[model samples]
Target: MRAKVTVMLKNGVLDPQGEAVKSALGALGFAGVDAVRQGKVIELDLAETDAAAAEATVRDMCEKLLANTVIESYGVEIL
Candidate 1:
């Protein structure tokens, strides 16, 4: 099974990297962009065959280590 996890900062959290990227985009003449948020994607291959089980496993990984649940939120997809 394959799973994908997306980890992103929760709203109201400070995102310095996102800010820097936004500034750079404006400097490069992309003025239409009003905001930017940065996040991470993790793809995993698992031995588990069931979609439900794979998704649950990935979500556990995110809660335990992949994401800092206090300041970040994560989504899991089974593929």
Candidate 2:
């Protein structure tokens, strides 16, 4: 099965990268983009098929290595 892990900074965390993107968009004449938040997308090809087990494993992976739980939150989706 394939899984996508989306890791995003918690609210109140500064996102300089996102800010840069927003600035560039504004420069390109994009209107109404008041703010932006940056996150990471990770795609994995795993052997797991059980939804609950896969989610748990990915959550563990995020907490252990992929994401900083102190400053970020994660959501996992299976495909």
Candidate 1 local distance difference test against the native = 0.94
The ten-residue window of minimal lDDT in model 1 covers 51-60
Candidate 1 lDDT by residue in tens digits, 10-69? 999999999999999999988789899999999999999999888888988998999999
Candidate lDDT (C-alpha), each: 0.94, 0.92
Model 2 stretches with alpha carbons more than 4 Å out: none
Q: Candidate 2, residues 1-79: lDDT per residue as tens digits?
A: 7889999999999989999999999999999998999899999888998888888898899989999999999999988
Instruction: Pick the TM-score winner.
Output: 1
User: Could you tell me the TM-score of candidate 2?
Assistant: 0.92
